[model samples]
Target: MTLNHFDDQFEDSPQAHDAERAEDLFVLLSCYLDGEVTPEERKQAERLLACDSEARQIYQQLSCISSGVQLMPVAENPVSAEETTAKVFARMRQQRQRRLAWGGTAIAAMFVAAVSGLSPHLGPNNQQFAHTPAPVSEDIGNLAPSETEPRSEQPLNREDITSRALFIE
Candidate 1:
């Protein structure tokens, strides 16, 4: 009935009845009570329950405690329905603010992309400048003098002279 009675039952071997072991069992029981225990641990606990009467009784007592703890009524808020609605509205407003912030960021990114895409066509000043055709120059005479009509026949090997001329230039 009492935790002390449960404590006394396992006092012969205090090491066997470690608080940590009980706490581990309590956690397992909590998971079991919530229907969240793994299949393996659940099977092990069930096997232990089948073989040991004391273990079963202790489990039953703990189960009673668990159920009692779970069934205890939670405290209700003192706030009126209007106040609750106000809190809900405030939360909605905060959520909307967050969404708006993300939306603004997306819009800014899109605007930047649009501007960058248009940059080459828009020129340096972001203004559309027309492509003007370059003016063509009138024909000019040959800048170099004619070789055959020249006076100095200094036995110029033309190929070697041209190659040397290219390097000299």
Candidate 2:
């Protein structure tokens, strides 16, 4: 109850020193109960429990406390195991759907942004963009053989190709 009450346990001994020894003995007894002591330490604990009635009483009290803890009521879950599993799976599916939707939207946004950003640069000043290639037709036989030397540095226009290409029959 008080320091003086514990102090009266040992005659002519300092209270702090005796208190520390009592705590050490109690911890040793607890470790022995939990089967955590080494073989040498176990022998020491067994000797202490055999010789001291106080150590034996403390060990018995600790055993009762431990067994009482095991007997305490366990909290019950409100949901059934099946319902919990179904809810977890449903959440995973929802998250997957959201990710897929976000990924597809991000790809489409990037494509639109890229096309819009480059459109202004694709004018007559940009020679690569200015020259529009002739559209391919499924009727391959109606196509004309390329007349200009493919290696020629000269630029040809639609006017230049009038003699060879897509003549109205």
Candidate 3:
């Protein structure tokens, strides 16, 4: 229906401010035509159709359209309900399988990293770098006080340790 015609039709009704009621009447009419309206809505629709010529015309038009749609032929290749359900379930199954595959790949990658010593910790309190041997030079080894000598109270020189570390010797 044209907007102009609909506006004119709405304007002709004395209860123009009651747009909500008009919408309810249209819903009632639709439900009635489909034989699905409650008794109260059916009574209201019938009363409106009897009193208002415009409402009666709209109801007639809707009824005619509903009948026309119902009379149309079915599609040439209609899929049955069971086939549609099967396709939907199959799609869901494929999605679940793909998700499982991705999860398994992530788990395998973490396991490989841990086994190859690339991970930060192999086990609790077991760091990868903790067991690595520090490089030592023969010069520093010789300068260390002999364990066989008498013990002394003096501390070792800090300068020598700093220079040895900085120069990698």
Which candidate leads the pack in lDDT?
2
The true-versus-predicted C-alpha distance at residue 98 of model 2, in Å, is 24
What local distance difference test score does each model get?
A: 0.73, 0.81, 0.80
Order candidates by lDDT, high to low: 2, 3, 1
Q: lDDT by residue for model 2 over 1-169, one digit each (tens)?
A: 7898766755456876777778988999899889999999899999988899878888899999989999999778678899999999999999999999999999999998878767755533444323444565688865675666365677787665864465422
Off by over 4 Å in 3: 1-28, 35-51, 71-73, 118-169
TM-score, per-candidate, Cα-based: 0.32, 0.38, 0.43
Q: Model 3 misses residue 143 by how many Å?
A: 39
With a 3 Å backbone cut-off (N, CA, C), the pairs that clash in candidate 3 are none
Worst 10 residues of 3 by lDDT: 125-134
Worst 10 residues of 1 by lDDT: 160-169
- TM for candidate 1 is 0.32
Model 1 lDDT tens row, 1-169: 8999877776757786676567666666666667888999898777767896655766888889877998999879678899999999999999999999999999999998888777775445556435433433454554456676767867878775554442311
